[model samples]
Target: MQKSVRLKSFELVAGDIRDVDVELLHALSISVRWPHRPKDWELFRRAGHGIVAVDGIGRVFGSAMWFPQGDNFATVGLVITTPRAQAQGGGRWLMDQILEQCGNRNLALNATHAAYPLYVSLGFTSEAIVYMRQGEVQQTLPALPTLGGELNELPSDRLTEITALDERAVGTNRARLLALLAKDASIATLSRGGEVVGYSMRREFGRGFVIGPIVAQNAWDAVHLTAVHLKNLEGRFTRVDTRERDGVFAEFLQRSGLGVAETVTTMSKGRRFLNREDKNPWVYGLAGHALN
Candidate 1:
């Protein structure tokens, strides 16, 4: 018998991401040094639809997911391709499938440095820079401004209280996504003059906990909202994704020991995806990179 026979080249095909085993998806992500865990994959699956690139033997080589926000907007993410397959046009193929599935809906995504050129070539416009911050929470948090409102715990059942505010900040009605997040997240809201002004959620993610979807009107409010969760997360690994480059909110995260771990570019196609105005609610912290 011949030993060590060379195998013939295999063709890649698109498959439903949900059909693959979670472990395979986990391995595919691990191959790229991504921090996503199996649980993260499950959450993303529940939140959106995706496709995986696989060969005849069922080995996954790449994946792409798009989350619909309302009827006309969507966010594309989890676009990954094995290093060995990147130069073989696997990434672009996966994206073409995603774009086709997303239809004519305006699309948005956060692109890593390696993936930036591909997205640009696909006609995505630069929008903003997102700072990926993570580290052990400080035992002592930095000084925060005087609480201008009442900070109170929000039961997951009362998710409606924040949906409108969240929609205002993200420009979409992500009630379904927020409801899914609230199922496992410890939620807090700031109230002033008998009105809910801001909110934040702390939940278990990749390595530890992530505090995010933090919606507020100003940096001071954002600081107070974040501190409410950091106080309890002292000395534990925590991550926060935000587009804030400077100001009180960004400074607060640095002071709390969550330094910038990496950066990703926020890009959009079709219509503008990010728009900020003074004295209006804004996304101080993102729910997740994929969810954005």
Candidate 2:
């Protein structure tokens, strides 16, 4: 539990997610027009440390979260402030609480163009561009690729492999979060000679299913992995948030019926930590803008 700090008429409480009212948090999200649903908020709470600002009347006005990735890295996200709370120091106070909790670890986040200045004021610099794409799946999509590796359902026994590959690709140890996601998400893996080479996971999120965290050796392999995940979702709404560098994969998604919806700039503070070794240019897609 975090000590509560009083600021003007508001109290900044280190979130005890179990006790923090999800309904209140959901209401805050809706007030800001954030896409996260109540279930998504639960997932974030379960996976990270958070802080919420409550007014004297006990209404949630602002919220922020930071997911620890290994010992030296963390990702901050879900920072929101009610319209009435904006420009009143609530957002900055929430950010300060999460940063203080994160200590000296490197921090990263996806910031909207509107919020980019605030993050820059906190010493963060743009690292990459992330685009959110979504649409109803087309009924007549191109056939899945037959080349590259064979795609199959990710086996429970491959948890170790999944974590290792994810760390190498994403530059962070998120085994605990991955474990939780695996339980509720449909995951597919591409294997060559019985060794897993790439993977993708699709799960119900927001308005529909979101396919992401796609990790692969190259653009082609990523397409293959993503195609396998999309095959089962034909005619259903699907969303994917991908990096701008993965333009080919993004094009493929656009061709398959999804359209670019919005863009966010990925920013980092302190030293950049994502490993992009040539052996495996892995992070073709992110788990989600928030999670990344």
Candidate 3:
């Protein structure tokens, strides 16, 4: 059931995200200087479910969303509150509602520096630092093939293989989300001996085209996949959000024309963290911090 709390001047009622207006969510994100478009909110609505806090006037004041990786894990994101609603406990309230819906499943979220302490108070611990890179693609780069693998466009027949690799790399079965992304994005894959080993997805995003969730066998393959994806995006705006641990790939992105934009802490409050294994870590880039 939805919850409600009373403030000094207005009543804050929690309800389903479907009940909240997408324009209001977009406005709330923009009020905080987030670079999300209405389409982004639509995408979130399709891939996950969320809760919204509405004021007495039926205006949305805060929101929170969670994408279930599977039965055992989920990722929470799109947590935002209007400036006027901050410190009134709306943010915390929305978080509590999301947690309630998640039950006892492990949960993960990326937190901004300002919001870091708040999540910590709720039992989330910082795990990794993620960096954002964005800029116009000024140069046309050559396709660098991965060793033992050839770079090519992702074939529709390889969806199963891609989803399997993604589940292993991201700890989630996002086949639905991946299918939607693949339909609208230019996908590049690295194949070895008729098997797809790595892949990258690039498509129009906040500012321009964003390439990510670049799952590859190693840094070399990751960079190669990235190059292949970028070759077609030359002279266009592009962005990539990558983990700090991908030191080599991060540096490569910098040299490729994208500049560091911001960094956020990846935090989790659960029994497990995504991509915790070191063996052939294929998640070189994330789909987005929100989805990761």
Candidate 4:
């Protein structure tokens, strides 16, 4: 594989799995239809870090892209295997290598029903419940926190600070992941103070803007930031996803006016990142659809 990565078929790779080739990934995305394409897959790897699993022929049969939540904890999932390459441990091999790669770090991942068993076999347990709420942009940012707000275009420096704050809100640092999302022309943010206290980045997914990563200092902050962000984009349809909010920001959106929508499980395996000394929970928003 290494020798072939040096070859023409697979040698066209660049950056990391996060941002390798949107076209290639877009091709792969067709394979990931059901749950929708989680923005972080494109964004996380775009942040300029991830593990690539290339076949000797240079085809990316399977890969797991991960971005660190901070210096210590890391959320590493987004395991993918080509449709032709599914089963037969192709996906598991990619995950195994990622688990080994992120051994000591507080690793997190979002698992699908098909792969949940693989994750459990690897020592992961369920973490949170993800709720998918679909509706028009409510056109309201709920009253909460500082209500501090600022609009930001990615690649702009403010996102850097917001990325840090987002980690604090979510307990995992993923500067690399946020960086990835910034590449898309549509990525943007809203902050309170000089610092980026909250943010929302979305893409023209399907019928509307699929709200990928929404972060803030708290529940209200996150929801507020999301509302303000969405209201700005008129005429476009929208869907905002929320993580299971049982922690400090328990059922935040439940009050934010988002209905139950649909439910998805945030599955995990291996060592968990709880209220440990190394990991801190400042999670104002979710890292991505899966892990983080």
The model with the greatest TM-score is 1
lDDT of 2 by residue, 89-126 (tens): 66777788788989999999999876788899899988
Descending-lDDT candidate ranking? 1, 2, 3, 4
lDDT of 4: 0.56
Q: For residues 214-285, what per-residue lDDT tens digits would candidate 1 score against the true structure?
A: 999889999999999999999999999999998899999999999999999999999999989876699999
Give the Cα lDDT of each candidate. 0.92, 0.81, 0.81, 0.56
- lDDT against true structure, model 2: 0.81
The lowest-lDDT stretch of 10 consecutive residues in candidate 2 is 9-18
Tell me the tens digit of each residue's lDDT in model 3 across 1-292: 5479765466888888887778998898898998888888888888889988887788887889998877788889989888876877777888888898999989888898777878999999888888888887758553443466787887655678688888778877788878767767888888889978889988778768889879987778888888876777788888888885446677678777888888888889877575556664567788887788
Colliding residue pairs in candidate 1: none
Clash tally, candidates in order? 0, 0, 0, 22
**Candidate 2: where is the Cα deviation over 4 Å?**
1-17, 143-145
Q: Give the CA lDDT, 0 to 100, for residue 246 in model 1.
A: 89
Q: What would you estimate as the lDDT of candidate 1?
A: 0.92
At residue 76, what lDDT does model 1 achieve?
96
The TM-score values for the models, in the order shown, are 0.96, 0.92, 0.92, 0.66
Shift of residue 267 alpha carbon in model 3, Å: 1.3
